[model samples]
Target: MPSTSTSLSPLSTGLARATAGLNLCHENASEVWHQRPPLDFLQIHPEHLIQEEGGTYRDQLDDLRHAYPIVLHGFGLSLGSCAPLDQDYLQLVKRVLKEHPEAFFSDHVSWSSLSHHHFHDLLPLVMNDETLDYLVERIDQAQELIGQPILLENISSYMRFRDSTYDEPSFINALTERTGAYVLMDVNNLWANAVNFGENPLTQLMEYRQSSVRGYHLAGCTRQQAGDGDVYIDYHGEAVHETVWDLYEKALRHFGPWPTLLEWENHVPPLERTLQEVSRITRYLNDLSVAPGAT
Candidate 1:
């Protein structure tokens, strides 16, 4: 069976020990591990894992799996969509899991489709009772079909509807309560939303269902002042901001050392750059742990 637990899965209560990773981008595939840096895992978007020849990377992936832990962070699941679960995609994911039973899977919490039309973006869902019930039902169905629990990620959104009755944390916690699923918290996305919507991330997300959050994602954002006002887009193209890094430290102080992933997609720097951030976060996490004989 597919691995349902993460390296720092919520099964443990105390502070997470030491888990850090980077997104598996094709750009750095050739120059991976500049001098073989220390990393705990690799966050993979399986859709991109396929070879250019339109064939799966069974051998290539298996070879890499031996060296590092792999976790699937997908974008196409569209777990919150009203449309029926994508059976073909689910089967593809299942095959992947079946081969690498140790690898875990997760997807965004936002909807990307309606009535069979895919929007190709992770759009925000209406955060209310109707949408909550709708999503829980879909997640329940998805879990049963996949035969494994999945983590829901908080994605970046450009707009928020007036119909959003519950705040992001409350809605996420509610979904976990009903579905028995875990959350893949994204610190960059949280910081972006707070900037765009005028909320305090340190306090606004203070009451998250900490026990259900096993991992986190941190990336760079691109800011823009549009007709709609200021916005911080999760461009994932630049180095992580100092502001976001400060917020991340607060989160580490508050939530303890959750397994954090350094994400770089668009303007991916050299493999060495990602390793530096990974080393930076790993060191910070080591420091975040309660010191030897503290108050």
Candidate 2:
């Protein structure tokens, strides 16, 4: 059976500090550590781990699993779509999990493709009673197929439906309450949505069922202003903003310390820079734990 718990070994604090200045794209992933920097966790995109020309991918995963704790973050599970679940994709995911028994498996809460049309980005779902019922049943089926509990991540969306009745937090809370699945909260996405949609992100966080959150995501974003409109995009490049850090601090206070992942997908910086961001978040987490009256 696939393992549900993360490993107990402490990430290399010294390596995390030493590479706190390196560029991410320039460095080869294989040479990420001269000293094997302590990583909080290494997240692999599921597609990257299991391609048809799968020899190198399998070898790399084998090497990675031996060195650090790994988590499988999938991009293709369209959990909220009206369409049926992709059995082939689920089978591949199951195979990967079977191979890496120690890794935690997770995917997004939003839907992607529908009716043979594939959208590369995670799109928002209409929040309603019908959608809620569909999601709960889908979550139950997915958990049974995967043979382990899956973490569903809240995704960033560029649009919302006028007909939608439920807000994001209430929808998520209801899903967790009914399905018993854990949440993978993405702080940058929440902040981006707040800036774009004029909703207070902190208020949404407060309304969420905190006990359902299993992990958190921190990423960099880009801000754009055109005419009277301004938007913050979850670009996952550059350094994380002060606003994101503040939100993360608030999240730590609300949900307590959970596994946090710093994502830098586009404009991959040096490994050191990524490590620095992770280090910074870790410092804040440590500080939060030591603060007076902190639980």
Candidate 3:
């Protein structure tokens, strides 16, 4: 049977400490309470929550659970690598899930490490039958060990494999069908690919297995023009672009309102700006629900 004890530990400790009046102040209490309208979800890096200093990371996670729904978005899982998945990384992820029972976990579909050497970037995967089978088997093992289905996200790519046998949508559709895992569709990635590769991102997204998508991600990109070719990098440092916003609206129509996370990892802005962007996405989703002709 699945256990919540393993997942609820961190939240329990955090809540206890928070209630002890340690960080509370008269001026900030109302603001904190109002903004803390049950965070839809928070994606955390494993390094931030998994520490060598013993209980500090665990304690911090416990406190975060009190105010927000936590999701473990791994930066180093490297699911599509030809090399075997890291056993130590998998064990750490399991421990985190056990510590935050309320958390949902996910990782990128791209690989970051090859032959045990870490590249620190989400590298594109070759879409082929062999790679598909390998990923399906690994996902099966991961699910067996973790006792829950995992979610995978599509990654942006600058180059395509010469030998790719499947398109991005077909690859993701097949993997989800074979492994029964969910998806975290990143809107910015879709837009970036469409702009760079001349593929209709909405068409690719429409080909996805609708039942497999659990959430969506929105982030900013950096646009550059070099000679006659233009490129957009998924920088996550600024406000979302109009093209990405349009794609997000399409996603809202296709998938309904699910958990959405606005990623602002670089060029860290004021807290208010980040909050405002999140609020804008939230309102956009809300408006979609009420809009006529919306499915």
- Tell me the lDDT of candidate 2: 0.72
RMSD for each of the candidates: 4.7, 6.0, 7.6
In order of appearance, the predictions have TM-scores of 0.86, 0.85, 0.82
TM accuracy, model 2: 0.85
Per-residue lDDT of model 3, residues 1-295, tens digit only: 1222232211111211001011112222344345554345556666554443446444544555556656677778788877877777778778878877765677888888877787968999889988888788787777666667787898888999988999888889888777767788888998898888888878887988877777788889998885698899887768889888888888888877667777876776655666677787778877876799864
Q: List residue ranges in candidate 1 displaced over 4 A.
A: 1-17, 33-36, 49-62, 115-117, 290-295
**lDDT accuracy of residue 158 in candidate 3:** 90
lDDT of 1 at 229: 79
Local accuracy of candidate 1 as per-residue lDDT tens digits, 16-129: 345888876666654553344567877667666543444334444445555677677888778877678888777777777766665667898898878877786899988999
- C-alpha lDDT of residue 101 in model 2: 66
Tell how far residue 76 is off in model 3, in angstroms: 0.6
> lDDT, candidate 2, residue 131?
85
Off by over 4 Å in 3: 1-38, 51-62, 292-295
Order of candidates by TM-score, top first? Answer: 1, 2, 3
Alpha-carbon error at 153 in model 3, in Å?
A: 0.3
